[model samples]
Target: MTATIIHLATPEDTVRLGQDLGLALRKGDLVLLSGDLGAGKSTLARGLIRTIADDRDYEVPSPTFTIVQSYPDLRLPISHVDLYRLSSADEVDELGLDEALMEGAVVVEWPERAEGALARPSLSVALVSDGEGRKALIDGETAALARLQRSLAIREFLAASGLAQAERRYLLGDASARGYETVAAGTEQPLILMNSPFNPGGPVLRDGKTYMQIAHLSQSVSAFVALDRLLSSRNYTVPKIHAGDLENGFLLLEHLGGDGVLDADGAPIIERYEETIRLLANIHQQAWPHEAEVGDGTMHHIHEFDRDAMMIEVELLSDWYVRRISGIELDGVQKAAYVAAWDAVINQLNGCETSLLLRDVHSPNILWRRNEVGIRRVGLIDFQDAMIGPSAYDVASLIFDARVTISPYLQDHLLGVYIHERNSAGSDFDEPDFRKALAIMAAQRNAKILGIFIRLDERDGKSYYLKHLPRIQTYFDRVVRHPALAPVREWCEKAGIFSPES
Candidate 1:
């Protein structure tokens, strides 16, 4: 545990730092507050609670008397605990403070009273009173340390980039190892702080490399910075990189509002989805280079969606999903056939010229700007995983989204619109070949999602992904209906993996 000593010059400094930490806190996290009776432990906890509540003036009364207060009304549930009044360790146990970690993040005052009764917290902040101020000592484990380090660097970056006093607020994050926050400095427009540090994958699983390496997933934020510059220059709706630390993976990007193509019921809106595909066609019309400029005299090379990568991705269906759902394991021959089918399709796509494939082109990554005109109205995010691959791969990603259910009728219509847009641009876009590529990619993508969604549910303790299993099956069925995917269809049918009707 490394100790970080921060000198809080004033009460304002203490609250400001607390707000920054508050944005980083999430469920299954803990923060231990230790201090003397009047060393501002309650003050710091109050700052966190108020910030999360989005009510600066809300009275966060200390839980010294009640021992705990639950703010279930807030967007993120919070449980505030006070160990100051607990005379015995058994009393702390009776309060069941550990349960708070599972439900939401907990902030405890005078946690030393419990001694070894609870698990180690994500952060332990110790306050010591100075003459007129205080000094805070922070300590945590690797994950927590990484977050703290990033927050410290962000504070420094904002200072250097002239957004020093920006009010940092928590924004939504996804299953990926990435985090985002909104920073509003003065009355100026808000900026997004993308915290996507390089997280090295575990042991070498494939060809002396990790899964991330095999998948060509971005390890750092430089790919994003480079792709952002390239797409923005092409008149696309990519966020502008205002300030950044590429090596350390901290970026200050323009905030694209979160108005995605999905409606309130989480279904695809017709006009927005059509516009999104048109934007994709417009992007595919251009000739993009394999190498792109990142910063001063530095260039980044985009990876290709080669046959090996394609096979490895589809293998996820066996590695994670089938293994978990049905306990169905693949033998050597079964695995080989799966690889061969994917290899045939990926090789077929490589025959023609390729375009930059932003691997993630689903609704979650798309933003709809009503005020903007033409293709510029569609804002794209999550391009760090982009590669030079078949343009049809992105088309499949859009129409066969995992989160939003794309019916066969709607999918066909969207596909037709995409083709029309390409033909309107006066390109020799072959419809039949594109359909075959789209079919292959749909199968490839659906296989990945089937495994990925199950992995998230079974291994990661996120059960909500199980709700989309049937939807993924339906899309997977649509994939194999094409003649090019007959082998994969036969394998899946004999395996009896998907649902009957699906």
Candidate 2:
């Protein structure tokens, strides 16, 4: 419903904007190209095609003579069409444009000849001459237009922040909507570009609060900036923030190198694991303020990982995992009992002394920097969801990681290392109490992961997460053995969740 007009002052601007559109393009989408001859329609199309192919030097021959050209090697098929030579809309149909629409995205030049056959809620790019440059107006439906606006926003961020001329390369993206890129400009030590927009999830799950509110998830890039300062102050390797547009959710951070804690076989490196544990041991003892300043005279108030947040995370088990394994959702009575069980444990968990919890201290978020000294050797990313919670929570996250299996022997050794380190700093650190809390937190974390993984599969179609269910089940089987989590163990047994093992 919104129209966005971007001033494409240069060919580079046009190309970068197209790349943004290309990244957001999905299968079965239509992009209508409208412009005069030599109006940069072909240039824009080339940029879009090259981005999808991930080839900077990709040759995109104009399809004016051929009517249409298809690229099958791309992640999705792309059909580049030229309708100027077409006689009528019927001739367009004879080219099997309908079938191409069924298969992949279609980008059509001179779309007006089709007489509005292109479909509504479509992206129409109008490229007109503007003095020494070109200006483009993007008109489309709300959803599609929103995506294009985000792309323009990113381009503006890069431009206004002096990174307009940087070379960009795709880095990584997760099951979530977030994506990252590496920016290299001249001799500048390459920076990481995080394109994480605040994702406000759907309807009121409870108390008029959405899932993010209950889970204490990062709703803005400001959270990452704040937590980055908090962790960096303690010598943790949260990436150094270079420039950021918090409103647009674009962050340019110092590139922490590519060495991960996982070896070639994808197992956790013992040496790195020990270092990660030691880092957590050291971090948990520090006094992190609830209020952190994120530079530019802005103060970010960190939200605590309180009862509602803890309970909401653990409820993921009942939400998705139960339906997958038991073939039904948790009924009213079962849900009530599950909630009561978690509520009681959360109360006891609150009694334990708390510290900053790196909610995802697992292998993927950890990078091994061998040359860096001490805790800085473990480069931390994704601590945007960091909150004040039990130190044992992060301990559980590290040892009982979801992505990588920490063997029983290594798990015990690492657990020992973590406990000894904590004891060194905390005089009144109760080993037995901490161990019980670790078990409680592990069970909660593993259960939440089970639901999250299954939801990723069922709803988001990320079946790759299903591969970790056995490991998660094993973690559940082990952690629920704690007397404090007996209620959860009983529920799991009744649900027949532990009938199989890895």
Candidate 3:
């Protein structure tokens, strides 16, 4: 229902527009290209196709003769259709466009030839010759229109960063609102463009704070940039911040290679996991500052993982996971009991040695730079939500990685590696106290994860997270049996939190 005009000064500019839009695109999208002959529609389509394929020089021949060209091997398989040769609009169905959309996106050139047969949610691009250049009049429904706007915003940000000519390639996006892209200018080293828009911490729940604010989640990219500098200064392998627009939440960061700690078969490589634990041990041994200065001379405070934050997180079990599987909303007394259960566990944390918790030290966030020496071999990312908490929290995060199934034997091996490294380096490392904290943190994290997975399924319409619930439940049962978590164990048993499927 809305329209935006993008001015393209040259054929390359048209291609750049396609590349920008390509980054915003998702599967099942339809792109209608309407333009006169020699209006560069094919050129733009080629750019978009090449970007999805992650290759700058991918071969994209015009579909004039073939009628349709399907690239099935790309990130999202896209079908480029030339409706110019179709004798009738009904022929559009014969081309299997509906089937193509089921798998990926479809781009239709000379859409007028279809005579409105292609009725779907589409981004309409009308190209017109403007002197020697071309202008694109883009219009669409809400989702498609929002995609174009986001793409244009990225273009504006890149232009301001003086990398207007950089080749933009979609890197990855997470469950959060953050997105990342790799932008390389000419033959220069590729850099990561972190697009993290400010999250207006949702409706205030208590004490005039949203869930994000109550839990100390980073509301902006300032935390990431500040933490990157802080960790890098301590000789850790966090991405070096090259440039950033803190106000707008865009950061051009060093592209730490995508070599994760997992092996080729998607299983954890014991060596890399051990090395990562050693790296974490080294990190926990050091005393970190409570606040670090951002590049803009503003202070970024690292919040303490206090009782309110912990209790709020654990309540996710009662609020989402319990209600989802059992359809039983806990009454006020039940919710109060749940809070009381975690109080004892949190109190026990008082005796544990405390340090900074990476909060998300798992397989996905960790990178194994094999060529790098010592602790630098372990590269860290996604530490923006880092908190000042028990040192054992990070160890628990690794030992019981939510994504990877770390067997009991393997978990013991990695935990032993961490304890050995910590005790060898640090003074007064009490093994019993550390073990108790690890158990408490592990149970707490797994409880939060169960509720989060269910919340993602019901609230966000993301069903994929449901598959991980069984794995997390098995891990939760193992840790909740610890003597340190008796109160939590008793509450979970009564609430039927152990039986997620039943």
Candidate 4:
């Protein structure tokens, strides 16, 4: 079953549709209103809020001047944010819209201004005005949308094409614009199928009867291309691209299923960490041939890890999450300590050799699969940001992960296993030197993660990441606790980098 697109006959119908959707709204759910100017965007938002609030006198005007307007009087405090006034993505966070998202329902006008800021919706209502009528398309997640879309009868036409069953099934999961879907043709076989008006980077069904991820072109396309090239030489598993219309940012790919490595239940923490480290070792071992193809050069360079760039990100954390939200002002001594600690870490990194490092190697980027031996195997994803850098960069990312917390014991055991594997692989790395490199890289990775989490919540309206800050900080503390990193730790402490009050 897939979601069906319906047309509304009048403005009244649009309001009614909004009211219907408002009745179903829940906490932490996002409603994105996308339409042209005067396409009844605000009118629809007004109807939704009115239905929930039921207060006739509540003024529901366009929030043009004020980026976000909150109405807490309703059953669920509704946040009416108008991004039309936003000058840049950074300004979105300053408006404190993320807080509104956390408390109640969010009705966003000109949401495209902060498109990636919101999570994938549970329902998306696109209003297209035509003459005296409007088009109202409702996309429900999984069950509701699938049942509706299948009733529309376009499924047969899509299936007859090269599109596979699995492709159709996956597309049915899309709660946004229809592009392609993955469906299961048989109990074991899946195929990729196409949806009309294909949006670049949106998911699509491929000829092999599997669903592929095609969400956005700018970053996803580049990332997948790099992953494709890497898979050609390594034993690692990434979603295989069956068919790609790169110009349109659409690709048919093999579905790796929804069960990711990090989502494994009751798995031993050390085992998970060990599997991940082994895969990283495999990635580092497979050297790219001089003639091997490379992805677009937009990836970050380790050489770009200069003093200025590092300081800018450190300042971002200090300004946004720490100072602005947490109200912790850095004293002069603390500031100087942070600077010195950062410099020491960077100076150490400057001396180590570099390799192809996947910048984002956290939980979400890895998929866990069951192997024949009943043990779980880890598969990597989201490597478009891969770059030439220190091998420890990836190790730090896995051990000091932001999404999940790994105990110090597991971290040490995993690190030992990784070192053993690397040494056995005939690499001539100095143990002492490698340990130092790991500490240096761990500090840099944690610093970058802090800034990213802030950006994700404040700038992007994804506050779920805020809860992981303490865990990530623990990783920083662990690294700095080492004798080799004592100087850096002293610097961080002096700077109040880990100040409990801060």
Candidate 5:
């Protein structure tokens, strides 16, 4: 029963409203647009499709005659259907919208012609003439309504930041609810609108704290702003925050080019990888403050990636992966043994050198600016979950990236590059200790990733991550063989954690 009324002062406002709602659209969603002739229904639909297509000037000819027009190549393939000519609700089935929805979402104009045959829509927009403009009465399911409200909030935030006229296009979204959009204003190069909402923490599960709290995940966008400013101060290549709404969790950030460490073929670029390692070495070599004052006059405190956090993440392997993947539930005795094994491994990190770790320095978070010289070519991002942890964690994360199938030769080369850079900088780079830390961190990360990928598939219905499980498993199997993780390897083997049957 969630509903909202939006006042559109102009045709542009109507289009913008559509764009706002488009941000929330997903596959299998039904967006019903009802209105009289010349009520801007088609115009609004055009804006929505264009936004989803990430092309502002995309041509969206009216589907009035065609009955249906499908955009199959877009990120979210959608079909625009016009039911104005339907004689009865029974005719609705002839349009094949139900079949279209199986591929993606559908936007139906003149849905009133369908009577009650259409399925319950995720969103319904009723447009009415208001003076020279229009008024839209919107209502939808709770999740859809919340997403629409958040999208409108982003619009308001952009307006307050003097980017009301900017063209916003869906860039990308992560496994988390956070999303990113590319905003273009005039000719001033594209900027990133970080659409991160305050996490508010999830349900409390342990020690009267939520999983996010135990994991030390960033609950506020201010962490990103603070870290960005901190790194920028140190001459590291991070997005520059032009404006931010700390409370509302919106940030207008610099777009640090589109190139990443991966090439067009999605293979790791060797030269870029070497430069990234150099950048990481420089960052690890520096001393960082535990707290920093951001532009908003609020102090952002960086948390330590303690043993508790690492242990909780490793437990994911048992909690989700073991049950779902291995089809076996761990008894109390087995669970405790598994925990004890991880405890011993995490304890090994006690005396290891600690530094600010970005947690995920994988290919996706890295951007390459080939035009920029030296380390400046490497742009760092997605570090909101940054923590003070073993510097080797970030190195391990990159070398054993969960997203890509890194060859063993490439892996060894990258490790060699990191170690050489650390040594070349005259940092007391304990080769043996660093190698051990890297192995332990690699195993821990891969275990957590396996659990997360399974959880994402079972809980979130995001099956895309399941493809990465094999790569991560291979990586984990290799790293757990290290002597530093002997106890963990033994426990996993005894528990049939990675049996051939699994």
Candidate 6:
């Protein structure tokens, strides 16, 4: 695949672009930043670092004299290396450049010195200083670059047509999936256009007042239809679908706001956590009285937690990740122990009552609306994976997330609140039993995530998720330590699953 190139028209634009890009960077990434002395290289680097490490006091000077300056305090260790003073490729190798690249995000100033030694970069930002401002040309094979290019191109086209002003630029991309594009608006309201070959779920846009969109038919057509049905029944704050061009997968949706609930930095973490958990409870608790009569009966039952299916998923994890990439051998005893652990989890979940499960209930999937009222006020997104399953499954998924850690105290408190609320509504759910199931579900979920993360990195070449291994392992550790699953915990410990501490 070819890399996308973006034109950064101004100094502010260059810095903004850098800051945006920095949010997507993770450990074990190679970002080659090349530019002349006055090309705003350090300025862009400073902006990128500031986004990741908010303190921003670290002097982002040219690493000419030092050759390499490492910042380990940040979530990902950043090695700012200047190869301007290097004599040859051998000198680059002598500096242990490869070792540094293996561990963290490596920003090379004069990568030409070690052109042959450097691996394929996730992103290569080349900055050129215009007499008036600066232009940034970002090149890379990654999906981020592709999405960035498409978005920049779209914005430029809209600007040239006089339909979009400079102030109303918006860029959206899936950092996890590695696809992105941008949109701009004119005096009239902006329309959501679904033009990507990938992401068939259509796009969303907002005018100055409200969100507008046309719905397009795709693999996720049922999801959109369900969302529309949900809007009618509940007073939830999801984006309203204004128009639809079903054939082309286009949608005009009411724009909620420029920022999502996840973007609220000023809000207290505990407050956000409580609000999010409460919203989840609302969805799980509020059931359609005619759900069985409403549509097709393809939904999996909560009580039907299949040991065979669970074992199959667990074996796939072993085959695709552990055995394939790590080359880890699971002997007869090891295999039997893993299966037993997985079977115990399945049996535990089978006893729970079924509820509406929003499988992907992480931070990114939720949108907090300030104007909405009550616990059900949160805006939900990415519900395509919705299913009927154990209530604790989604709860476990949210609390023991691999990407971000919810505080242990808050997680426990939310569990208490969720169970209390459910019981108050005449549900016969048991708290102690639910907590045990949650621990098992968490272990199963983390195991699946570990496999998925590895597949994304090794198979798809999206290595950004590799850094999340430690966080995922932490979740596994917490789950395995549960007294109810002590047998499973001992087996995992022997297998070195939590060997690498985050």
Q: How would you encode candidate 4's per-residue C-alpha lDDT over 32-96 as one tens digit per residue?
A: 78888877888778877876775434578778898778888777789888898778876666776
Candidate 6 displacement at residue 432 in angstroms: 2.1
Error of 1 at 319 (Å): 1.2
Ranking according to TM-score, highest score first: 5, 1, 3, 2, 4, 6
The alpha-carbon lDDT assigned to residue 247 of candidate 2 equals 81
**What residue pairs clash in candidate 1, if any at all?**
none
Instruction: Give the best candidate by TM-score.
Output: 5
Q: Tens-digit lDDT track for model 3 on 187-240?
A: 456888999989998899999899999999999999998898899888899887
lDDT of 5 by residue, 50-155 (tens): 9998887899998888889999999899899998876788988888888888889999999988888999998999999887678999998888788888898888
TM-score of each: 0.93, 0.89, 0.92, 0.58, 0.96, 0.57
**Model 4 poorest 10 in a row by lDDT:** 209-218
Off by over 4 Å in 5: 1-3, 499-502
In terms of lDDT, model 2 sits at 0.83
Alpha-carbon deviation at 233 in model 6, angstroms? 2.6
lDDT of 6 by residue, 391-491 (tens): 78788977876667666786788787777777777866687877887887787778777777887777667787888887776777777777767766666
What overall lDDT goes with each candidate model? 0.83, 0.83, 0.88, 0.61, 0.88, 0.61
Per-residue error at 102 for model 2, in Å? Answer: 5.9
Q: In angstroms, what RMSD does candidate 2 have relative to the true structure?
A: 2.9
Q: How far does residue 35 in candidate 1 sit from its true spot (Å)?
A: 2.1
User: What lDDT is obtained when candidate 5 is compared to the true structure?
Assistant: 0.88
